[model samples]
Target: MPLTILTADRDLDDRAADAVPLPHAGADHWRRPYRPGPGRVGAAAVSLLLASFVLLSAVIIVAAGALPAAVICSGVAVLIIALALRFLRVGVWVSAHGLRQVELLRTTTLRWSEVAAVRTVQRPVRWLGLPRTVQGQALVVDRQGGSSLRTLVTDHNGDFLARPEAFERAADVLEAWAAEYRR
Candidate 1:
């Protein structure tokens, strides 16, 4: 099965925005659009490579008269394809309800009432025990220790460094909306 990112109801989001009192809430909602990012491209390449390897291995196993091995390889190939599809859809979606981080096989959703704070954290890109570069502006959500500091925007989902300005704006919207709704 191909991985599918659930698209929020735009009509509903618009309606919610009207009902809510947050600025830029209606027309300018935050969504992780399928933009061409390095992480996204890399994920595609890795998935393709794994799928190709599985196909070749399966062919070889069948030629060697190992039916069981061939079957296992086919299964692995299916899994690889599914994983790749999911990776393609990885993103964060924000609506009036709250936020949704779409992953390979799961989604983490936080309601507006559940959010305690939104903050930025700095991360380091390290190699051989040294920080060669720093990961700029990771947006985290604090659910008052319930979920600790959950990163809503990061390279893992093709946000943050991938689309810094958009990520920042989304983070601002989230924090402001949460604060307003909490009251």
Candidate 2:
């Protein structure tokens, strides 16, 4: 479904600010809100291009009967694609039900009430974190410090990973949804 952002949540993380306002669900304008899937900077595309070069080179090596070299190059090409996809996992979602934290095989959704706060954490340098998938995105949600729920997020998904600032926009979406539903 298409996710058109109405307004964003401003105080989801601001301790000094008020709580996240909520709008009643099923309102005329109320529909699920999800963030734009991470932008594709063509990194994967570039990776593919490079992998093609490597595989082509492998073919040349094979022609010369350099079986070891060809196999090595072919293997390298496969590795490149795999690593790129790993570094760039896609499917980070946001909706009225809650925000979705995506991963390679499984996905998790954080409901509105369970949503404690959303904020951008500053690090000395950009970290391509994995497992939690906070690598490049700046939007870090403190899932109200759920007793057992671990935070959900994956590293980067192409270009959007580098622009975690988009998370602020993501936060706005959450805030706006809350306002519309004002429950």
Candidate 3:
């Protein structure tokens, strides 16, 4: 109490106290830390356009007094819309539960216990999930017990195509989550 010196640590503490708290992924819910790229948005737009055409044809069929055909067209339009929604949902998601990778036709989830490591590596990644490969970074997940490595997210994927900084931040966040939960 005789002499109290405001050291660097104390100064940092004061600055931190005044700093705005940033939002983080919730402990209980799922979060997608990256933004969807143009490829995904374009696909969704095409899907919606197809759905609209189908719906319009359904209306025309209904006007032509073909009730059954109109109903079938309506159903097909609904299915297309559902597929578009699913396409939009395709990406990497993280939560307390684990990491989830949603593809066009399937979803894979790996628990934190099952994950050995999540790291970013430079490699040839599919360009927007196409056959054309591009030299970029990918976030790969290694499972425990020598299982096959899974590529969770790639800089060329729909979530990060042409966005290197965003990909790096997403990879870092994923690595942090894996590190926190793997312990």
Candidate 4:
């Protein structure tokens, strides 16, 4: 169905997951895909470079008769491999029904209606386990849609990844979906 848009105060509070009744955004609401922030995948390359350096160093030290040079080289190799994996581990994606949370360890999806709230907060000097963003950080979307009981999805792992600056994108998609379908 064609949708009509409104400018009412969209005051949607976040809450835990349940078979909650959907809110009424009138007849003008529409459906759209939630776009998440874009992720900059530069770390993988850096990891490879570091690994090469580590190997090169290991070779040089071994030539100089450094004891246990093989062990040191193995350590650098492991570090490089780990960093590369983490780099490949980042991403962002969304759908009409839910958002995809991508991480080094796993990926998850959350539905639209369960999105209780999306708040953009500062990434702090140290967020999750990294440096702060020059621009204010994205947001943490609370949802009861995912399989996991913990419903918070943070951008540290490209949870709402549309463009990194796609806060409005996410909110818009979430609003559109919620307007049309509720939970």
Candidate 5:
């Protein structure tokens, strides 16, 4: 017997043994993997253009015999690449237990019991401190907390608004699940 086959069999056996039985677990558990939509792709394209511009600037600076300035521009380009990679990894995961928002730097989970309300609200994109783009619908999650009224999901960066219809559909499914499984 090959070691690879032995290792695979052992892994399968381990997973089967570790799996716990649930009373109601099959199709009731909803799952969604957030993928990049047209809006998100466009956003990424703009970032790529900006990065190219930065690289061009660096080349120009180096041609002018300014090694330090070119290094600074290269550093800025690296920072932009890091930030873009982080943004691309942002995702939302929905299950029977809760809705989890996964980002590059942080993850937040809100249980069905914790959620008070899920509603759409108008959000405007701003430029130079003034509203510039058309107002879009933002999915807001109201949750109960101590002190004054608290909220959980704000959709601050317009992730939920990127595809309003799809987002609303997902939100509707989540709301239905919450209603059915509220504890």
Candidate 6:
């Protein structure tokens, strides 16, 4: 007698179809349409590097029999790592539920129903989220029944810095998503 193994016969699509859909309450439900630029990535990289050094110094301090100093260094390392994570998370995210603008210290979310229009405009936008501004295009979000225009994505932001084509494509995708979901 030959031993045989039995398995369910199903295609990939069938298995995928059977999977339960995830709830739209978190980052998993959102999509980033653009890539982070060198400035943001570089800052995060530098932060991680500093954290590594701090961790190494902590280890050395522990070997040198200074427990208190080692603990402090470890804490600093943890803070640096957190900062790097924050840098990585700063960006614009879109979904059927809404549009999200994530900053270093704040996040703003606008539902599709609240959005009046998402259009590209020629204006001065922050350079890499800096105080200094540069002449560029921005994806402005107009709220329903409001005169204030919220700037969502900018050509000079981390995602589209020095990438004009990517800015255009991302703006179009965001506009399309707004159009489709607003109805």
For candidate 2, lDDT tens digit of each residue in 103-179?
Answer: 55566776767766654444332333333433233445655565523333323433335445654555566556544
Ranked by lDDT, the better of candidates 3 and 4 is: 3
lDDT of 3 by residue, 37-81 (tens): 667878899999999999999999999999999999999999999
Query: Candidate 5: which pairs clash?
Result: none
User: Across residues 1-183, which tens digit of lDDT does each residue of candidate 4 receive?
Assistant: 422233111223234223353676333333223322223334566677788888888878878888597677869788778867755545444455565555667776656667665555565322333655433454466556533323233444343333343445554554454455444
TM-score for candidate 6, residues paired by index: 0.80
Q: What is the lDDT of residue 103 in candidate 4?
A: 62
Clashes (candidate 5):
0
Per-candidate RMSD vs. true structure? 8.7, 10.7, 10.4, 13.5, 11.2, 9.3
lDDT ranking, best first: 3, 6, 1, 5, 2, 4
lDDT for each candidate structure: 0.65, 0.55, 0.83, 0.51, 0.60, 0.82
Model 1, backbone clash pairs (residues 3+ apart or across chains), number: 0
Off by over 4 Å in 6: 1-28, 147-149
lDDT of 5 by residue, 60-120 (tens): 9999999999999999988877777666656656676876666668877777678766666
lDDT by residue (46-133, candidate 6, tens digit) is 9999999999999999999999999999999999999899988888888878988888788999888988988999989899778999
**Residue range with the least summed lDDT across 10 consecutive positions in model 2:** 2-11
Predicted structure with the largest TM-score when compared to the true one: 3
TM-score of each: 0.57, 0.46, 0.82, 0.41, 0.50, 0.80
TM-score of 4: 0.41
Per-residue lDDT of candidate 1, residues 1-183 (tens digit):
523344223323446556755575473465553343555667688888989999999999999999998999999998888888887767666666676777667888877677777766777432211335554556677785567544555533443344555555566766666666555
- Looking at model 6, how many pairs of residues clash? 0
Backbone clashes for every candidate come to 0, 21, 0, 12, 0, 0
TM-score quality measure for candidate 1:
0.57
- Best-fitting candidate, measured by lDDT? 3
